[model samples]
Target: MNSEKQKLSVLIITLNEEQHIKSLLDDIDFADEIIVVDSCSTDKTVSIVESFKNVKLIRHRFVDYTSQRNFALDQAKNSWILFIDADERLTPELKSEIVTAINSENVASAYFIYRIFMFKNSRLKFSGWQTDKIFRLFDKSKCRYNEERTVHEKLIVNGPIASLKHKIIHFSYSSYEDYKSKMYHYGILKANEKLAKGIKPSFLLQLLHPLYTLLYQFIIRFGFLDGRKGVIICYLNAYSVYIRYKELRTITSSKI
Candidate 1:
């Protein structure tokens, strides 16, 4: 271990995430600063965060994911920012690797960290999650999330990008109902994003696209290998697609 610690700012965006906030804060205590941009959480999230004297919590209104993330970026005092989610966890090995990476002589502007997705305490190995990676650790001076994306935000890095060796453990959903609600929320956001781009919905696509998604995830992506849980995940994923177009149609129809 290095005797000197790096000047790093850990950023997190939260909304009613009382269940996982404490553990996440404890894990990243090695950082010099921790900034949490909360979206007016009604739960004990704000109170729990206040317990940590080192954490700086800012209450911001909920908009899109991109805007929330970009707003978090602006509040960071350090140049190096590790933007992690409330549902994600970092291992001891990964913590060491992160320190080494930033302290290296030839460090990249941004680094991609892979994750192991979990559904209801079960590790999901398939359903298009095998290659799940996100740009969590990066230089704030050279990177910012794309504003156009409302759901799955994309990070635009001005310099070189690299990948980390260790992976994060992502507890994606607490229950089936929770997962379904999250998917539906993502679907609605996606629909609004498409509408903003002047893209209209089609009835045929709403019907066929979901079926294709089911088949592609379960059969092509080997989701069947995971057994019963895989089937549920695949179905819900397809359902989210259906809900997206359904909501889009509902929004478009109200104009008349």
Candidate 2:
């Protein structure tokens, strides 16, 4: 009867995430190895990471989310990998569950972890964030991020998948301005991804898609149930869609 615990490696990709790095590092201290692939952040992020003797920091050039994550995957030495974001925190229940799952004899290739989205101090219950989940923990040898996606990267798991009970606390936005900037950045990345896949943008798409998104999120998804926060989130979601098409049009038009 062999009884050896599985070694876990934690990977985090960061860029000027000084505010969340330290706390996140503290939370994931149980890992056998911790790797932080930074995009040359011009902040105290690197220094804060350096304070953790257990963390291995690698500065890589920013290409896209998928590439950055894949780069981090290559750097991991352990069989089990937990890819966590700087702004996300794993609760004690989730951490314990992860430890138990990896140590079990019949472990899945990957696990889907749900997230509780937070806007500053408030936790938004709606705004299309009710069913947010991500593949964060998995076997390093069996999973890799999809190269095609640049913004919202998806994992390509080779084997069986399972879902965890507890959820990760995602402190998504620090401020309104910060959230808007991130949405715009994500919109640009998504537009580039669509362009790569030979997808063209239309004026009607730029106009109507945003309206549809606003209605779908605010009304259909019950975003309005959350009140003021819901309104802001739904509007931003619509704005992101508008920016995506608007950017796609700009890029295509420039080539002509």
Candidate 3:
């Protein structure tokens, strides 16, 4: 098939994302089709998406990230797909690269995209965030999200892969409180998932495990070079780790 004729389908899953939906929709409008698999949001998110051109909105019951994402994948009509989160933006460089790649005669089955995380309107260059990469753009026939993972779910690609130099922007958190709330929520989800696997968070593991992540991110990964921002990230990471095990311990103790 000719590269220019190969259309790209962009997909996203949303709940109540009024604050970030419209901007994101506008950013990804360059794609041939915009597929939004919303989780029945009781807000202006759906209406905002409907206002966009070349967009198709489908509502589904929320379960887990992987399940919702996999469901979104099935909704795409094109062979090429690009997945973007509500808090992410498809930058101009990435947009051009994506179109160019799909137009290539010999394109990889999947592409790994790095993220430029935003916090307080600042781009995080370190704090272990520089390592944030995901297989987001790919041929739908050769890729699918693994539904088993509750958090940190990954896409399973069945063919050759490549990387893009440009990065998509991610608005990681709006405020410190928001970050903590996310930590609390994701931590519990992770804990429950671990419990389901028959893995227990021991007394020491609960305490020490989190510190290891802090050290690794701040020291080993040079998160400290990011300055005060790095400190906050490292601390939040440790807090999230602790919260996950704390939730795990609570859940397990109740069962006992």
Candidate 4:
């Protein structure tokens, strides 16, 4: 298939993402079309997108990450879709890779890209974090986000997957406060998911899991190489687990 005829589209789901959308838009403007599915942003998110003629905006209520993403996919008018988060930007190399993939004859229906996670001014490359890949680019017709009741949603694909060369830049945490707050929010969602499915963890399991998580991410994942930032991420992940299990116990005990 010819590259120009493929009609590549970029789909993004936003909610008060004004601070991050500018960079995302700048990087992905190379797409044939841009679709923004917003859950009613109270900030200037809509206005900023309004400045771009290539961007099409759709408003919908918040359900979950998967639902919002799938809704965006349903509205896209392209055969090829690149799903990007508001905080994520496609690096120049990644954009070039996507173009090459779209123009190729035997490319996979879905492709994974490495992610470079940044926090504050530091990019943590180690402490057990390396070669982290996400299935972001997909053929819209044969792929969609699974409507899973989880915070980190993944795409469901029907064809072979490929890997991209450049990394997707993820501004995961701008501040320490933001990181802690997000962990709390994600912990709530995880605990609720566990509680809904009748999955129970023993007290010992809860106590040991957080430590194991910290060690795994820091030692095994090599997050330690990220310096102070790596240590912070490892600690936050461990704390997130502790909070999640604590929430789970509370919810379960209430039901009993």
Candidate 5:
């Protein structure tokens, strides 16, 4: 279809995402164009992408998630852009809904899609991971990823958003080792963001944060319903809090 008649573009930012890129790309083949903004990955990621036809690839250094997303947004030629993570894939239902939504004139500027987080090739229904909504598909001009932080990049937009029904599968972590590595890296970024904002937690507060996280995720969120997997996720979530605080303390100590 022509740009004016029926045009939808897929934007994915990647860095060493060789394992997950092919699966994600396979699901969104219905899009008119696919733009991959890579951060100089030193893996087979770029080579695999080169095998795909009509996929536009751009390379740039990694600064943060927001700027990388903005780069991809600028490269998207089509008016409609669906931003997705390299580890994420659009389901059949979501593709159908997106195509339908694009054809409609009265559809909202952006929409939130449910995310299904998976671990060890199994979908985690509980553990506060399922039924999570994230604003991903939006008009390129109306929205942008906030450049304020790193780990949790917020989609800062001026208008209201709509919701979609289908789920986007997220194979975020393959193993516990990978999860721990991510915790350390993301915790560092989060601590830096907090410090930049002049926010600091007291000693007791920081210590209690992890415990509260465990309680909320395991009990309040009913994570235990998911069985052993739920317990593991809750523990990991709590550990993330501890790692963030430790990183924060390290930053302060280094400055002193």
Candidate 6:
């Protein structure tokens, strides 16, 4: 079958992301089906999603990313699913590649797309983010999320995977405050995940991890190449690690 003849579903999960919702939805109009699984957004997000045609909106309670995405995958009608975040936009080349890839014979169970991270509207080429990639596009039957995870969940692919050349743009940090707020909360989530798994807190992770993260990103990863933006990102990354362990300490303490 030709690329245009093959159908695919695009799935996205959103909360109160009114400021960051429309761009991603507008970019993936090429998909045969666009499904938005929202966790009860009390903002203009729902209205904006309602404006798009060929888009089906679903309201589900907020769970971890893995379970929520898996639920969204189940709601998808097509054999192929493209999972995207609210801050992510599909480039034209990637959209074309995805359409072509889905229709190809002997295709693998999934595909990996490299991500370009944008911080405060500036694209950061260094800061150890250049290697960022995710396996998001896949055949629904052969792939599902690892629901046991509480954060940074990995997809489970039952078969071989392929790769695409073009990149997906991730406007992950709209502002410095936004980045800090999100990362701190992410720290809490990660800490809780570790605690639930019976992983005890460690002084090495709590005390040394943050410093190691800073040096690794700034020096080893050549984060200085991005100049001021790189320095900012590097510091924030280290801070996030610090917060994670600190939160873990608190969780462990509360239990005792």
Q: lDDT score of model 2?
A: 0.93
Off by over 4 Å in 1: 1-5
Better of 2 and 4 by lDDT: 2
Q: Which candidate, 2 or 6, has the higher lDDT?
A: 2
lDDT of 3 by residue, 128-184 (tens): 888899888899898887766887887888988999989989997788888888787
lDDT minimum window of 10 residues, candidate 5? 1-10
lDDT winner among the candidates? 2
Candidate 1 contains a number of clashing pairs equal to: 0
State residue 203's C-alpha deviation in candidate 2, in Å. 0.8
Expressed as tens digits, the lDDT of each residue in 169-248 for candidate 2 is 99997988999998999999999999999999999999999999999999999999999999999999899999999999
Count of backbone clashes, every candidate in sequence: 0, 0, 1, 10, 0, 0
Give the residue spans of candidate 6 off by over 4 A.
Answer: 1-4
Instruction: Estimate every model's Cα lDDT from 0 to 1.
Output: 0.92, 0.93, 0.87, 0.84, 0.82, 0.87
Residue 254 Cα positional deviation in candidate 2, in Å, after optimal superposition: 0.8
lDDT of 6 at 146: 83
What 10-residue stretch in candidate 6 is worst by lDDT? 1-10
**Comparing 5 and 6 by TM-score, which wins?**
6
Candidate 6 lDDT, 2-76, residue by residue in tens: 445668889899998898788787788788889999999999999999998778999999767777888999998
TM-score of each: 0.96, 0.98, 0.94, 0.92, 0.93, 0.95
What would the C-alpha RMSD of candidate 3 be, to one decimal place? 1.6
Error of 6 at 95 (Å): 0.9
Give lDDT tens digits, candidate 4, residues 122-161.
Answer: 6778755577788888897888776656677878889888
Q: How many backbone clashes does candidate 2 have?
A: 0
Maximum-TM-score candidate = 2
lDDT of 5 by residue, 6-111 (tens): 5888998888999988877777789899988899999999988888887888898887777788878888888788988888877788899998876766777788
